[model samples]
Target: MKILRAEEEEALSEALRVLSEGGLVGFPTETFYGLGADPFNPAAIERLYEVKRRRRDKPVLLLLGDREEVGRLVEEIPPVAELLMEHFWPGPLTIVFRARTDIPPWLTAETGTVALRVSSHPLARDLPRLFRGPVTGTSANLSEEPPARTAEEVAHYFPEIDLILDGGPCPGEKPSTLVSVVSERVELLRPGAVPWEKIEKLLKSFS
Candidate 1:
């Protein structure tokens, strides 16, 4: 794994090039570094699973730089999801929605729903927009291992990756809260940086 400081446009462009070529990249997100790959590239996604030793049954999430990218993946954005996106997107909330049938089959595994987030971290957020598509947002770590907060740590864990965009150290907070809106109701899958209480309160106001 090569560690390239993401201090210049040149580095980001090269990272994008790697992504375009279906190679893996480690990028800094608000909570931790996320491994990036073209969501449409099945071979790349399989390689990611092999590298992380992650089970194929556990689906990975997609990182978006723009909300418009959402239309390209999900079958529909339920009202609850739209409301949550309005309030918590570009932050730390990852909302899972029913995937469109045309979306890459490998992305949703057996869940048939795709987890999506509009990241606030500059690099993580910008990469998708630059590439004009979503990127896999799985934490850059081996399965069951703690997520990496620094580029060096990512390098330590993954030597099989194509590149690591070293955006210094991440904020290293709790990882993003994960929720699902695919069942016609909001369900909390993982409570994290975004407190469940706050999400409950907001939904309560409308209910």
Candidate 2:
């Protein structure tokens, strides 16, 4: 597998090329190294699941360059979701929304909802912007293994992955907080980088 430094322009360009061609690229996020694949590509998504040995039932999370991209995947952006994104996005929070009809079943795992995060990490944010589409932001480790914090750790787990954007060790070393907003209320699915108290306070403010 080719290893590239995330800061280099040439590496970024190559990573985009790989994604456009339906290949996987391992890159660092605020929390951990994520295996990125074009979320719109069924072949790429399937390969990602196969490589990580991820269960098909568990849906993958998507990373976006900005909040606007959320509309492309979900049917509607609820008021509570908008409030949360306004406060905590471009950071470590994944919000689940009712997906648009066009989104693939593989992406939603037939749950009819998609989890998304507008990443603050430079590599994570720029990648989707450059690729001009969403990318899978799942941790680059075998299912149930500790998430990889460094590119080297990712290599040990997914040596055959197409490209590695080595941005050095991730600062957070934890997954994003996951919340489902299908109903009017916000349900905390998983808590990690963002504290639950913070989210609760934000929701209370909206009320």
Error of 1 at 92 (Å): 0.7
Model 2: per-residue Cα lDDT over 58-171, one tens digit each: 999999989998998999998888899999989999999999998999999999999999898988999998788898999889999998999999999998889999999997
Measured with C-alpha atoms, the lDDT of residue 176 in candidate 1 is: 97
Q: Which stretches of candidate 1 lie above 4 Å from their native place?
A: none
List, residue by residue over 1-207, the lDDT tens digit for candidate 1: 567889875888999999999899999999999999997888899999999999988889999988878888899988898889999989999999999988776889877889999999988988998898889999999999999999889999998899999999998879999999999799999988999999999999988
| Per-candidate total of colliding backbone pairs | 0, 0
TM-score of 2: 0.98
TM-score of each: 0.97, 0.98
